[model samples]
Target: MPARDGDEPSFAVAADRSQWRYRPRRAFWRSRIVRAVALVTLLALCALVILALVREQTGTEGFLVGLGLAVLPVPLLMAAFRWLDRVEPGPWKNLLFAFAWGAFAAALVAILANSFAVRWIATATADPGSADDLGATVIAPVVEETAKAAAVLLLFLFRRRDFRSLVDGVVIAGFTATGFAFTENILYLGNAFGEDQDLGDGGIGAVTAGTFFVRVVMSPFAHPLFTVLTGIGFGLAALAPRGKRLRRVLLPVAGLLLSMGVHALWNGSATFGGPLAFYAVYAMFMVPAFGLLTWLAVWSRQRELRTIAGVLPAYAAAGWLSPEEPLALSSMRARRTARAVASRTYGKAGARAVGEYESFATTLAFLRERARRGTVPVPDFAAREQELLHHLWERRATASPALSYAARATGRVWVPPQYLDYGGYNPYKG
Candidate 1:
């Protein structure tokens, strides 16, 4: 018999009822573990090889100095990215993988490929200086940006659920670039320290201090800035309707090209126009671009909060959530106060439940928005929606009261009888 217009797909209906249980596919049992292990091993191998190569080039004392100084900015950078992702944090595992890939796999590839290309150019033209110049201005940017973009591409493909938003793209790309910069800094600083040692000027006036000031102080965000353009491209693609294959493909490619172009320009600044030109470009172009992207990321985060406030009221009306959850969840201040209240009331367990509740609800909001926009196919929508709702329901015992209290405490009073249309989203309807 043909299904009616409003009928739920039978499989999706079944998925909702199977909420308390999870059954992984047989392939997950067989292939996924093996694949994960293989990837880890490969990353580890790359890390070891790169460590040996860098150490050999920099020598022990220089490597030690570089390692110590190079680590200073990593924690701060990671924290900034993590803060931007507070609305819908990707799994830590994904961020870890991305960072590792950048530090090891991407760095290794860039070094080896750049070295090979520069050598070839030098041999072909019999001009090591020209080859070095070309490598910095052209080959390095293309190789490095593509290498960093590989990790972003991997996450966008395999971790589609977490990679849906523009902020998500920015965060992931930022971490990857951060890791790459960390490794690259180690090399450059290590080499500078070696030069300082050779010149018997290992103090304030040394080359190491100048290198540190340039790489660490002045332009720490350089790699991240270049790569995030590619991420924005992927993120925009993610928001596109699934049927628009050409848009998805083209957006990311366009982003990659843009990233490569900017990277090349930045690299060529020193070669083409000298120190004054470099500073001019940095002040005129790089700073403005950074400010613009930073604003975009923050604006997108607020928009996400508004979306949650707007969309989740339908769920509240249907009794999946309390009347005040939408309002409370939308405000970060309320969200924090709610967690504090939870902690005071029932200790860490209560706080944990509220935190999980917050995460699940945010994810649910994004999932619904995507579904409504046709970015998520209908067949998959039912299952995912059910899963998120199930998690939310499980934590409601603790989360609901905290959220309600937060609503009141933070002046987020809920006025009811709105958002009731369901917008084709009522899963409980048979």
Candidate 2:
């Protein structure tokens, strides 16, 4: 049946079941929950395998020591990324998957590939020294960056909606790199401990201390910094118009290449000019680059807020939202205040509903803006916008009052219209 005057538009085509040529033999496996469970199980298996391999190489005591030390920076890095994503946070499941993919699958691939390449170079060239140098400066960078990038690419491809913005790419990539760094640190620290034991040092050995200082204390952000370049590329690609396929493909490749070059340069610093070169690169290049990227990520986050504020007024004018909602939603402080007011008045459920409303509103703004720009396909945009609007409508009872109060409290100063009853006003219809 065709849509009626009061009905939302239907973008989906109706298909006849009798006309199907083929159907899945195992329909149960096609469910999203089933696919998710399978993916998680696979990642867990990879983690177990990698853990076993590392333990075998490092020994039990070394593995334990490495595990303890390597965990120090994980929480800090994860927290920093999570903080950056506060404006429009992606689902935690996506973050978790990225981390697991990095920690297990990507790390495992890097280890196997690097080790194989190094061994092959050693045998073919009859020079252990050359193999070690080549692996560090060439093979390791290419392999590890590519391996880590796989996770980012997978998320970008499979979770396109959640992976919409630059901040989303950065956060997802950061989590993946954090996991990769954590696993890599474990291996490096564990090996250093093993070497220390070989020297019969009863206490804290020089090798172990040096590795810990470098990997944990000094340059814990090293891996994440490298991968974030690739993420920036994907984020930019996500913003590209749908017709610009070449730009989309080239952006990510350019980012991956840049990541590989930087990784190689950092690795080769020690070989080029010894300790002075390494420190010089760290002080001059690494520190400044990290600072620049940090600024960019934060600026992008603020830009998202500005975008929301700019685009949402149209929806408000259309009666999809209260007049004061866009202003209140754009300010992070106001958003928080709104949630707090809901929590105080209606307890946890109200707070949760308010949070959902905020998310839906922000998402709707983004979708509509993209639609206007022709970046998102029309049908997909229509369906997603309608879905988000419906969600916002459902929670408006709890969310609107809180947001209106927030707007007034934050100085936006909305007065109730004399013609409409403020308490019972129906602000939206789907």
Candidate 3:
């Protein structure tokens, strides 16, 4: 029999009821056990750190003071990097872990390896007394840069998509460098504190405070800024056309050379009485170079926005968006506005879905650009594009009901069935 007017189809109603009834629940005890294990592991690591620090030093006061001083500059430097990462921000947890790896794991390895290399080189050259200078100028730069840069390289290996541009690379690289600098500073500050203890408390406190001021305040950017240049090189290398393997290799090599040279110059100039020469070199060379590179990043991001805007017109015409909506989609402001509409209509869950859809769109744009430039293999590109499209559809479906309601209330339809079809939103028949 034919379905009656204003009456729901029996099969459609049954399917909707089944969907509502389908809820997958996990065993509560299993989840609790996993959380318990993770908590224990974290506690174990903390215990190990405390044990190691206690065994290595005579007094806790100097170490605590050093740790306090060392941690102060990290947040400020991280904020600066965050400002630079506006175009493509990384996952905060991943970024923080990278920083921790650089500060603790890399710092420990670098100090050991650098010390060993310096000793070996000095002995081989019959210049035992020159070990400290060699370590500072040559060994330290090579070891520390490699160690800190390793954090960024690891990020590339694991989370390649997070590294969309030079600024993204610089942010990760800077955080890693900041981590290394923090740990190293703690050691130096702790030693200074201990040394000061031999003198009167006033004298010790004054000297320690002065050293902290000069190191942490006057030149906090020294290490992170140096490493960020190399990161820019790595990011460019990652985005270079696939066939230009040699160019990719050369870019990072040149960047590393630039990093080492800057580091050596910084150390060399510090040996002099004043920073006049260092300041001149930085102002004349480093500042202009970094400034130009930063300008290029901003220009590239703007170009990306224009490219996305140009390409999206076809979808807009197909009813996926209004003509004006495409213009809005080209800006983060508009994206945020859309998210707000989703939230007000459907609550936080709908807002989250909207955000995910936006993220998927951004990823799709990046991948498409890479494919167009031949940076990604053409054969695999289609599959990746489809995967991103599927995710976009799922997120859009979650946000769609609210969006449709909003459109109706305002008498300004933004997305209709034709839009859904254009966006590949195929409903599950099962």
TM-score of candidate 3 versus the correct structure, residues matched by position: 0.75
Q: Quick one: ranking by lDDT, best first?
A: 1, 2, 3
Query: Model 1 RMSD to the real structure?
Result: 7.8
Alpha-carbon TM-score of each model against the true structure: 0.91, 0.89, 0.75
| Model 1 regions more than 4 Å off | 1-23, 28-31, 202-205, 414-430
Q: Which pairs clash (backbone N, Cα, C closer than 3 Å) in model 3?
A: none
- Worst-scoring 10-residue span by lDDT in model 2: 14-23
lDDT of 2 by residue, 276-303 (tens): 9999999999999999999999999999
Candidate 1 residue lDDT tens string, 1-430: 1122233323433354434223345465466778889889999999999888899999988888899989999999999989999988899989999899999999999999999999999999999999999999999999999999999999999888779988888999999999999999999999999998888884524689989998999999899999999989998998999899999999999999999999999989978889999999899999999999999989989999999999999898877788899999999999999999999999999999999999999988998999999998786787677777767767887998899989988889943444454775655555
Each candidate's number of clashing pairs is 0, 0, 0
Better of 2 and 3 by lDDT: 2
Residue-wise C-alpha lDDT for candidate 3, range 119-187, written one tens digit per residue: 898889888767777788777888888877777877777577677666677788888888888877877
In model 2, what is the error at residue 203, expressed in angstroms?
Answer: 3.8
* Residue 120 displacement in candidate 2 (angstroms): 0.8
Q: Which residue pairs in model 2 clash with each other?
A: none
The 10-residue segment of model 1 with minimum total lDDT is: 1-10
C-alpha lDDT values of all predictions: 0.89, 0.88, 0.69
Cα error, residue 333 of model 1, in Å, equals: 1.1
